[model samples]
Target: MALGWKLVVDAGDPHRQAAFWAEALGYQIEDNSTLIERLLAAGTVEQSLCVEFQGRLFWRDAAAVRHPDDPFDPVSGTGLGRRLLFNRVPEPKAGKNRLHVDVHADRGQRDATVARLRAHGATLVRHVKEPGGEWSVLTDPEGNEFCVS
Candidate 1:
Protein backbone atom coordinates (compact mmCIF):
# COMPACT_ATOMS: atom_id res chain seq x y z
CA MET A 1 0.00 0.00 0.00
CA ALA A 2 1.12 3.51 -0.63
CA LEU A 3 1.97 5.67 2.33
CA GLY A 4 -0.14 8.74 3.05
CA TRP A 5 1.56 12.08 3.31
CA LYS A 6 0.99 15.82 3.47
CA LEU A 7 3.31 18.66 2.55
CA VAL A 8 4.23 21.12 5.26
CA VAL A 9 5.48 24.59 4.38
CA ASP A 10 7.07 27.12 6.70
CA ALA A 11 5.54 30.58 6.92
CA GLY A 12 5.68 33.68 9.07
CA ASP A 13 1.90 33.75 9.42
CA PRO A 14 0.31 30.38 9.08
CA HIS A 15 -3.28 31.56 8.94
CA ARG A 16 -2.63 33.93 6.07
CA GLN A 17 -0.70 31.29 4.20
CA ALA A 18 -3.49 28.78 4.69
CA ALA A 19 -6.09 31.21 3.43
CA PHE A 20 -4.08 32.14 0.38
CA TRP A 21 -3.43 28.54 -0.59
CA ALA A 22 -7.04 27.58 0.04
CA GLU A 23 -8.29 30.31 -2.26
CA ALA A 24 -5.63 29.72 -4.89
CA LEU A 25 -6.20 25.96 -5.03
CA GLY A 26 -9.94 26.00 -4.48
CA TYR A 27 -9.37 24.03 -1.26
CA GLN A 28 -11.05 24.17 2.11
CA ILE A 29 -9.20 25.33 5.16
CA GLU A 30 -9.32 22.59 7.73
CA ASP A 31 -11.27 23.87 10.70
CA ASN A 32 -9.74 21.90 13.57
CA SER A 33 -11.84 24.11 15.83
CA THR A 34 -13.77 21.22 17.26
CA LEU A 35 -10.57 19.57 18.36
CA ILE A 36 -9.31 22.85 19.73
CA GLU A 37 -12.45 23.53 21.67
CA ARG A 38 -12.36 20.05 23.09
CA LEU A 39 -8.75 20.45 24.07
CA LEU A 40 -9.40 23.82 25.61
CA ALA A 41 -12.28 22.43 27.61
CA ALA A 42 -10.23 19.46 28.78
CA GLY A 43 -7.24 21.63 29.56
CA THR A 44 -5.16 19.40 27.36
CA VAL A 45 -3.86 22.31 25.29
CA GLU A 46 -3.03 25.85 26.26
CA GLN A 47 -5.28 28.64 25.00
CA SER A 48 -2.19 30.70 24.22
CA LEU A 49 -1.33 28.24 21.49
CA CYS A 50 -4.32 29.12 19.36
CA VAL A 51 -5.96 32.07 17.69
CA GLU A 52 -9.22 32.97 16.01
CA PHE A 53 -9.24 33.64 12.30
CA GLN A 54 -12.23 34.11 10.04
CA GLY A 55 -14.41 33.25 13.01
CA ARG A 56 -12.62 29.90 13.43
CA LEU A 57 -10.11 28.76 16.00
CA PHE A 58 -6.70 27.76 14.70
CA TRP A 59 -3.39 26.73 16.16
CA ARG A 60 -1.20 29.82 16.32
CA ASP A 61 1.76 28.03 14.88
CA ALA A 62 0.05 26.14 12.09
CA ALA A 63 -2.83 25.98 9.67
CA ALA A 64 -3.75 23.72 6.79
CA VAL A 65 -5.77 23.46 3.57
CA ARG A 66 -7.18 20.27 2.12
CA HIS A 67 -8.84 19.16 -1.05
CA PRO A 68 -12.60 19.57 -0.84
CA ASP A 69 -13.38 16.01 -1.80
CA ASP A 70 -11.04 14.33 0.67
CA PRO A 71 -12.25 12.43 3.68
CA PHE A 72 -11.57 14.05 7.02
CA ASP A 73 -12.05 13.39 10.69
CA PRO A 74 -15.29 15.09 11.63
CA VAL A 75 -14.32 15.63 15.25
CA SER A 76 -10.86 16.98 14.52
CA GLY A 77 -11.56 18.40 11.06
CA THR A 78 -8.28 16.96 9.86
CA GLY A 79 -8.00 15.92 6.26
CA LEU A 80 -7.03 12.34 5.47
CA GLY A 81 -5.65 13.06 2.04
CA ARG A 82 -4.17 15.79 -0.07
CA ARG A 83 -3.31 18.29 2.60
CA LEU A 84 -0.86 21.18 2.73
CA LEU A 85 0.10 22.35 6.20
CA PHE A 86 1.58 25.78 6.82
CA ASN A 87 3.73 26.13 9.92
CA ARG A 88 4.97 29.32 11.55
CA VAL A 89 8.70 29.98 11.52
CA PRO A 90 10.81 32.81 12.87
CA GLU A 91 13.05 33.15 9.81
CA PRO A 92 11.80 34.60 6.55
CA LYS A 93 12.27 32.80 3.25
CA ALA A 94 15.62 33.78 1.74
CA GLY A 95 16.11 31.54 -1.28
CA LYS A 96 14.27 29.61 -3.95
CA ASN A 97 12.28 26.61 -2.88
CA ARG A 98 14.06 23.34 -3.54
CA LEU A 99 10.65 21.74 -3.88
CA HIS A 100 7.55 23.42 -5.24
CA VAL A 101 4.02 22.73 -6.29
CA ASP A 102 2.78 22.76 -9.87
CA VAL A 103 -0.82 23.73 -10.42
CA HIS A 104 -2.29 22.43 -13.64
CA ALA A 105 -4.94 24.66 -15.17
CA ASP A 106 -8.06 23.08 -16.56
CA ARG A 107 -7.81 22.73 -20.31
CA GLY A 108 -7.09 26.19 -21.72
CA GLN A 109 -7.87 28.11 -18.56
CA ARG A 110 -4.27 28.81 -17.55
CA ASP A 111 -4.55 32.57 -17.99
CA ALA A 112 -7.66 32.89 -15.90
CA THR A 113 -6.23 30.68 -13.20
CA VAL A 114 -3.03 32.70 -13.06
CA ALA A 115 -4.98 35.95 -12.85
CA ARG A 116 -7.12 34.66 -10.04
CA LEU A 117 -4.05 33.65 -8.07
CA ARG A 118 -2.47 37.07 -8.67
CA ALA A 119 -5.57 38.72 -7.26
CA HIS A 120 -5.01 36.65 -4.12
CA GLY A 121 -1.51 38.13 -3.60
CA ALA A 122 0.63 35.65 -5.55
CA THR A 123 3.31 37.63 -7.34
CA LEU A 124 4.59 36.52 -10.69
CA VAL A 125 8.29 35.71 -10.71
CA ARG A 126 8.66 34.91 -14.39
CA HIS A 127 7.17 33.07 -17.34
CA VAL A 128 8.93 30.03 -18.70
CA LYS A 129 8.64 28.69 -22.21
CA GLU A 130 10.67 25.55 -22.57
CA PRO A 131 10.77 22.87 -25.22
CA GLY A 132 8.77 20.65 -22.90
CA GLY A 133 5.97 23.20 -22.28
CA GLU A 134 5.14 26.66 -21.02
CA TRP A 135 4.40 27.70 -17.45
CA SER A 136 4.30 30.76 -15.26
CA VAL A 137 6.05 30.79 -11.90
CA LEU A 138 4.49 32.68 -9.05
CA THR A 139 5.30 33.01 -5.41
CA ASP A 140 2.65 32.75 -2.76
CA PRO A 141 2.02 35.49 -0.22
CA GLU A 142 4.96 34.15 1.77
CA GLY A 143 7.32 33.75 -1.18
CA ASN A 144 6.80 30.02 -1.71
CA GLU A 145 7.10 29.11 -5.38
CA PHE A 146 4.39 27.38 -7.37
CA CYS A 147 3.71 27.06 -11.07
CA VAL A 148 0.62 27.40 -13.23
CA SER A 149 0.54 25.54 -16.53
Candidate 2:
Protein backbone atom coordinates (compact mmCIF):
# COMPACT_ATOMS: atom_id res chain seq x y z
CA MET A 1 0.00 0.00 0.00
CA ALA A 2 1.15 3.51 -0.69
CA LEU A 3 1.82 5.77 2.22
CA GLY A 4 -0.33 8.88 2.60
CA TRP A 5 0.99 12.29 3.57
CA LYS A 6 0.27 15.98 3.68
CA LEU A 7 2.75 18.86 3.58
CA VAL A 8 2.91 20.70 6.87
CA VAL A 9 4.17 24.21 7.47
CA ASP A 10 4.77 26.19 10.62
CA ALA A 11 3.19 29.58 10.81
CA GLY A 12 2.43 32.36 13.22
CA ASP A 13 -1.05 32.60 11.83
CA PRO A 14 -2.26 29.22 10.61
CA HIS A 15 -5.62 30.34 9.26
CA ARG A 16 -4.07 33.08 7.14
CA GLN A 17 -1.53 30.61 5.86
CA ALA A 18 -4.33 28.21 4.96
CA ALA A 19 -6.23 30.93 3.16
CA PHE A 20 -3.22 32.01 1.10
CA TRP A 21 -2.24 28.47 0.19
CA ALA A 22 -5.84 27.55 -0.67
CA GLU A 23 -6.04 30.44 -3.13
CA ALA A 24 -2.58 29.79 -4.52
CA LEU A 25 -3.21 26.13 -5.14
CA GLY A 26 -6.88 26.28 -6.09
CA TYR A 27 -7.70 24.23 -3.02
CA GLN A 28 -10.59 24.21 -0.58
CA ILE A 29 -10.15 24.97 3.07
CA GLU A 30 -11.01 21.99 5.21
CA ASP A 31 -13.94 22.73 7.53
CA ASN A 32 -13.33 20.34 10.47
CA SER A 33 -16.00 22.23 12.36
CA THR A 34 -18.28 19.22 12.74
CA LEU A 35 -15.52 17.26 14.41
CA ILE A 36 -14.60 20.16 16.62
CA GLU A 37 -18.18 20.64 17.68
CA ARG A 38 -18.50 16.97 18.50
CA LEU A 39 -15.33 17.05 20.56
CA LEU A 40 -16.49 20.14 22.42
CA ALA A 41 -19.89 18.69 23.19
CA ALA A 42 -18.33 15.51 24.54
CA GLY A 43 -15.68 17.47 26.51
CA THR A 44 -13.03 15.50 24.73
CA VAL A 45 -11.24 18.67 23.65
CA GLU A 46 -10.74 21.90 25.50
CA GLN A 47 -12.90 24.85 24.51
CA SER A 48 -9.81 27.07 24.64
CA LEU A 49 -8.36 25.15 21.75
CA CYS A 50 -11.15 26.21 19.37
CA VAL A 51 -12.10 29.47 17.76
CA GLU A 52 -14.88 30.66 15.48
CA PHE A 53 -13.88 31.30 11.93
CA GLN A 54 -16.50 32.39 9.44
CA GLY A 55 -18.85 31.50 12.24
CA ARG A 56 -17.58 27.92 12.29
CA LEU A 57 -15.44 26.35 15.01
CA PHE A 58 -11.84 25.65 14.05
CA TRP A 59 -8.80 24.43 15.90
CA ARG A 60 -6.89 27.48 16.99
CA ASP A 61 -3.50 25.94 16.32
CA ALA A 62 -3.96 24.53 12.86
CA ALA A 63 -5.72 24.84 9.53
CA ALA A 64 -5.52 22.97 6.25
CA VAL A 65 -6.33 23.10 2.56
CA ARG A 66 -6.97 20.26 0.20
CA HIS A 67 -7.31 19.81 -3.53
CA PRO A 68 -10.87 20.55 -4.55
CA ASP A 69 -11.41 17.13 -6.06
CA ASP A 70 -9.76 15.13 -3.30
CA PRO A 71 -11.67 12.71 -1.14
CA PHE A 72 -12.01 13.82 2.45
CA ASP A 73 -13.75 12.58 5.56
CA PRO A 74 -17.05 14.39 5.97
CA VAL A 75 -16.93 13.84 9.71
CA SER A 76 -13.48 15.33 10.33
CA GLY A 77 -12.98 17.37 7.15
CA THR A 78 -9.54 15.89 6.72
CA GLY A 79 -8.36 15.36 3.15
CA LEU A 80 -7.26 12.00 1.83
CA GLY A 81 -4.97 13.42 -0.85
CA ARG A 82 -3.10 16.49 -2.01
CA ARG A 83 -3.30 18.45 1.17
CA LEU A 84 -1.31 21.07 3.09
CA LEU A 85 -1.57 21.70 6.79
CA PHE A 86 -0.42 24.79 8.60
CA ASN A 87 0.22 24.67 12.30
CA ARG A 88 0.56 27.59 14.64
CA VAL A 89 3.88 28.31 16.35
CA PRO A 90 4.69 30.86 18.99
CA GLU A 91 7.83 32.12 17.24
CA PRO A 92 8.03 33.80 13.85
CA LYS A 93 9.75 32.05 10.97
CA ALA A 94 13.49 32.45 10.94
CA GLY A 95 16.27 31.39 8.57
CA LYS A 96 15.58 29.43 5.36
CA ASN A 97 13.25 26.52 4.89
CA ARG A 98 14.91 23.14 4.67
CA LEU A 99 12.11 21.97 2.38
CA HIS A 100 10.14 24.28 0.16
CA VAL A 101 7.28 23.95 -2.31
CA ASP A 102 7.53 24.68 -6.01
CA VAL A 103 4.49 25.99 -7.84
CA HIS A 104 4.60 24.97 -11.49
CA ALA A 105 2.45 27.20 -13.64
CA ASP A 106 1.00 26.30 -17.03
CA ARG A 107 3.48 26.85 -19.84
CA GLY A 108 4.90 30.37 -19.97
CA GLN A 109 2.67 31.51 -17.12
CA ARG A 110 5.25 31.57 -14.32
CA ASP A 111 5.71 35.29 -14.24
CA ALA A 112 1.99 35.93 -14.28
CA THR A 113 1.52 33.41 -11.51
CA VAL A 114 4.21 35.04 -9.40
CA ALA A 115 2.61 38.43 -9.91
CA ARG A 116 -0.73 37.12 -8.82
CA LEU A 117 0.80 35.55 -5.75
CA ARG A 118 2.50 38.82 -4.91
CA ALA A 119 -0.80 40.61 -5.12
CA HIS A 120 -2.11 38.05 -2.70
CA GLY A 121 0.61 38.90 -0.12
CA ALA A 122 3.64 36.92 -1.23
CA THR A 123 6.96 38.76 -1.27
CA LEU A 124 9.17 38.51 -4.34
CA VAL A 125 12.53 37.34 -3.11
CA ARG A 126 14.62 36.93 -6.25
CA HIS A 127 14.77 35.40 -9.71
CA VAL A 128 17.09 32.57 -10.64
CA LYS A 129 18.33 31.56 -14.06
CA GLU A 130 20.71 28.72 -14.86
CA PRO A 131 21.47 26.55 -17.82
CA GLY A 132 19.06 24.00 -16.44
CA GLY A 133 16.09 26.35 -15.69
CA GLU A 134 14.67 29.57 -14.36
CA TRP A 135 12.28 30.31 -11.49
CA SER A 136 11.24 33.00 -9.07
CA VAL A 137 11.75 32.55 -5.34
CA LEU A 138 9.04 34.03 -3.18
CA THR A 139 8.05 34.11 0.43
CA ASP A 140 4.50 33.57 1.57
CA PRO A 141 2.65 35.95 3.86
CA GLU A 142 4.48 34.47 6.83
CA GLY A 143 7.94 34.48 5.20
CA ASN A 144 8.17 30.83 4.25
CA GLU A 145 10.03 30.42 0.97
CA PHE A 146 8.57 28.79 -2.12
CA CYS A 147 9.27 28.91 -5.83
CA VAL A 148 7.34 29.65 -9.00
CA SER A 149 8.43 27.90 -12.16
Candidate 3:
Protein backbone atom coordinates (compact mmCIF):
# COMPACT_ATOMS: atom_id res chain seq x y z
CA MET A 1 0.00 0.00 0.00
CA ALA A 2 1.09 3.54 -0.62
CA LEU A 3 1.38 5.99 2.26
CA GLY A 4 0.22 9.59 2.30
CA TRP A 5 1.56 12.58 4.20
CA LYS A 6 0.54 16.11 5.15
CA LEU A 7 2.93 19.04 5.38
CA VAL A 8 2.01 20.48 8.77
CA VAL A 9 2.83 24.13 9.40
CA ASP A 10 3.06 25.53 12.90
CA ALA A 11 1.71 29.06 12.89
CA GLY A 12 0.28 31.59 15.29
CA ASP A 13 -2.87 31.67 13.19
CA PRO A 14 -3.48 28.35 11.51
CA HIS A 15 -6.65 29.45 9.79
CA ARG A 16 -4.93 32.43 8.21
CA GLN A 17 -2.08 30.28 7.03
CA ALA A 18 -4.56 27.82 5.61
CA ALA A 19 -6.33 30.62 3.80
CA PHE A 20 -3.13 31.91 2.29
CA TRP A 21 -1.81 28.51 1.31
CA ALA A 22 -5.13 27.44 -0.16
CA GLU A 23 -4.98 30.36 -2.58
CA ALA A 24 -1.29 29.94 -3.22
CA LEU A 25 -1.69 26.34 -4.23
CA GLY A 26 -5.07 26.65 -5.90
CA TYR A 27 -6.45 24.07 -3.49
CA GLN A 28 -9.82 23.89 -1.80
CA ILE A 29 -10.24 24.22 1.93
CA GLU A 30 -11.54 21.09 3.58
CA ASP A 31 -15.01 21.40 5.06
CA ASN A 32 -15.61 19.53 8.32
CA SER A 33 -19.10 20.69 9.20
CA THR A 34 -20.60 17.27 8.97
CA LEU A 35 -18.35 15.98 11.72
CA ILE A 36 -18.69 19.17 13.68
CA GLU A 37 -22.44 18.98 13.53
CA ARG A 38 -22.42 15.31 14.50
CA LEU A 39 -20.22 16.00 17.47
CA LEU A 40 -22.38 18.90 18.56
CA ALA A 41 -25.56 16.84 18.26
CA ALA A 42 -23.99 14.02 20.26
CA GLY A 43 -22.93 16.44 23.01
CA THR A 44 -19.33 15.49 22.36
CA VAL A 45 -18.53 19.01 21.28
CA GLU A 46 -19.67 22.23 22.83
CA GLN A 47 -22.06 24.52 21.01
CA SER A 48 -19.24 27.04 20.72
CA LEU A 49 -16.78 24.51 19.37
CA CYS A 50 -17.50 25.48 15.78
CA VAL A 51 -16.46 28.84 14.48
CA GLU A 52 -17.45 30.80 11.38
CA PHE A 53 -14.79 31.31 8.74
CA GLN A 54 -15.67 33.37 5.69
CA GLY A 55 -19.31 32.94 6.82
CA ARG A 56 -19.06 29.14 6.96
CA LEU A 57 -18.79 26.99 10.07
CA PHE A 58 -15.35 25.48 10.58
CA TRP A 59 -13.27 24.06 13.34
CA ARG A 60 -11.19 26.79 14.86
CA ASP A 61 -7.35 26.73 14.98
CA ALA A 62 -6.83 24.12 12.28
CA ALA A 63 -7.58 23.70 8.59
CA ALA A 64 -6.27 21.86 5.55
CA VAL A 65 -6.33 21.79 1.75
CA ARG A 66 -5.62 19.02 -0.68
CA HIS A 67 -5.37 18.18 -4.37
CA PRO A 68 -8.78 18.35 -5.97
CA ASP A 69 -9.01 14.64 -6.77
CA ASP A 70 -7.59 13.37 -3.49
CA PRO A 71 -9.63 11.16 -1.22
CA PHE A 72 -10.84 12.43 2.14
CA ASP A 73 -12.45 10.79 5.10
CA PRO A 74 -16.07 11.81 5.40
CA VAL A 75 -16.17 11.60 9.16
CA SER A 76 -13.13 13.77 9.97
CA GLY A 77 -12.65 15.41 6.55
CA THR A 78 -8.99 14.42 6.56
CA GLY A 79 -7.30 14.44 3.17
CA LEU A 80 -5.34 11.53 1.77
CA GLY A 81 -2.84 13.16 -0.57
CA ARG A 82 -1.13 16.39 -1.54
CA ARG A 83 -2.23 17.92 1.72
CA LEU A 84 -1.10 20.87 3.74
CA LEU A 85 -2.20 20.94 7.39
CA PHE A 86 -1.94 24.13 9.38
CA ASN A 87 -2.05 23.96 13.17
CA ARG A 88 -1.95 26.63 15.81
CA VAL A 89 1.27 27.49 17.66
CA PRO A 90 1.63 30.12 20.33
CA GLU A 91 4.89 31.56 18.98
CA PRO A 92 5.22 33.64 15.83
CA LYS A 93 7.34 32.65 12.87
CA ALA A 94 10.87 33.98 13.09
CA GLY A 95 14.16 33.63 11.21
CA LYS A 96 14.21 31.64 7.99
CA ASN A 97 12.41 28.49 6.95
CA ARG A 98 14.83 25.59 6.73
CA LEU A 99 12.32 23.58 4.73
CA HIS A 100 10.11 25.15 2.10
CA VAL A 101 8.07 24.09 -0.88
CA ASP A 102 9.27 24.54 -4.48
CA VAL A 103 6.74 25.12 -7.22
CA HIS A 104 7.47 24.39 -10.87
CA ALA A 105 5.45 26.21 -13.45
CA ASP A 106 5.33 25.56 -17.17
CA ARG A 107 8.53 25.84 -19.15
CA GLY A 108 7.99 29.52 -19.94
CA GLN A 109 5.53 30.50 -17.25
CA ARG A 110 7.90 31.24 -14.38
CA ASP A 111 7.38 35.00 -14.57
CA ALA A 112 3.60 34.66 -14.61
CA THR A 113 3.77 32.33 -11.65
CA VAL A 114 5.87 34.86 -9.77
CA ALA A 115 3.32 37.58 -10.44
CA ARG A 116 0.46 35.38 -9.31
CA LEU A 117 2.33 34.41 -6.16
CA ARG A 118 3.06 38.04 -5.39
CA ALA A 119 -0.61 38.85 -5.85
CA HIS A 120 -1.32 36.10 -3.34
CA GLY A 121 0.86 37.89 -0.74
CA ALA A 122 4.26 36.46 -1.59
CA THR A 123 7.17 38.81 -2.08
CA LEU A 124 10.07 38.26 -4.42
CA VAL A 125 13.10 38.02 -2.22
CA ARG A 126 15.63 37.35 -4.96
CA HIS A 127 16.19 35.87 -8.38
CA VAL A 128 18.79 33.41 -9.57
CA LYS A 129 19.97 32.56 -13.05
CA GLU A 130 22.78 30.47 -14.40
CA PRO A 131 23.86 28.51 -17.45
CA GLY A 132 21.69 25.72 -16.11
CA GLY A 133 18.39 27.56 -15.67
CA GLU A 134 16.63 30.28 -13.69
CA TRP A 135 14.41 30.51 -10.63
CA SER A 136 12.90 33.01 -8.26
CA VAL A 137 13.12 32.84 -4.50
CA LEU A 138 10.10 34.27 -2.75
CA THR A 139 8.80 34.61 0.77
CA ASP A 140 5.26 34.44 1.94
CA PRO A 141 3.80 37.18 4.11
CA GLU A 142 5.01 35.30 7.17
CA GLY A 143 8.57 35.05 5.78
CA ASN A 144 8.64 31.46 4.67
CA GLU A 145 10.82 31.15 1.59
CA PHE A 146 9.83 29.10 -1.44
CA CYS A 147 11.25 28.69 -4.91
CA VAL A 148 9.58 28.99 -8.29
CA SER A 149 11.15 27.49 -11.37
Best by the TM-score measure: 1
Query: Which lDDT tens digits does candidate 3 get at residues 1-149?
Result: 97767898887766777787888788878888788888888999887656788767777778888877888888878787789988877888888888999988889999999999899789999999999989999987777899999
The TM-score of candidate 1 is: 0.97
lDDT of 1 by residue, 1-149 (tens): 99999999999999999999999988999999999999999999999999999998999999999999999999999999999999999999998899999999998998899999999999999999999999999999989899999
Stretches of candidate 1 off by over 4 Å are none
Query: Total clashing residue pairs per candidate?
Result: 0, 0, 0
Local distance difference test, per candidate? 0.95, 0.94, 0.83
Q: Each prediction's TM-score against the native?
A: 0.97, 0.94, 0.90
TM-score of 2: 0.94
Residue 27 displacement in candidate 2 (angstroms)? 1.0
Q: Against the true structure, candidate 1 has what lDDT? A: 0.95
Worst 10 residues of 1 by lDDT: 107-116
RMSD of 3: 1.7
How accurate locally is residue 77 in candidate 1, as Cα lDDT from 0 to 100?
96
| Model 2 CA lDDT for position 39 | 94
